[model samples]
Target: MRRLIFWTTVVSGIAAAYLLYKKGVPPGTIASEVIANPVGTLIHEL
Candidate 1:
C-alpha cells in the first residue's frame, strides 16, 4: 500500500514536470507565482 502511494506520487510528479516543460513554464516562475499570489493563482486555475 505504501509502495503504491509512493510510486503514484513519483509518476504523477514526473508527468506534471513533463507537461510543465512542454508548456515552456520555468520552475522559478511557478515557484514565484505560488509564493507571490497563492490564493489568486488557485482561484484563477479553478
Candidate 2:
C-alpha cells in the first residue's frame, strides 16, 4: 500500500543518515575523497 511504501522510505532514510553520522562522515565527502584517492577510499569502505 502507499502508506507502507512511504513509511519504509522514511525509516530507511533515517537509518542511512544515522549510519553516516556514526561513521564520522558528512554527506558528499565520499565523492570528493574518491576523486583524490580512489583506491584508498574504496578500501576504507570495506
Give the deviation of candidate 1 from the true structure as CA RMSD: 6.3
Best by TM-score: 1
Q: Candidate 2 regions off by >4 Å? A: 27-46
Give the clashing residue pairs of candidate 1, or none: none
Runs off by more than 4 Å, candidate 1: 29-46
Scored by lDDT, model 2 comes in at 0.58
Assess each prediction's global lDDT (C-alpha) against the native. Answer: 0.60, 0.58
lDDT of 2 by residue, 1-46 (tens): 9998767655555555555556888668644564455444544555
Candidate 1, position 4, lDDT? 86
Q: In model 2, what lDDT does residue 42 have?
A: 44
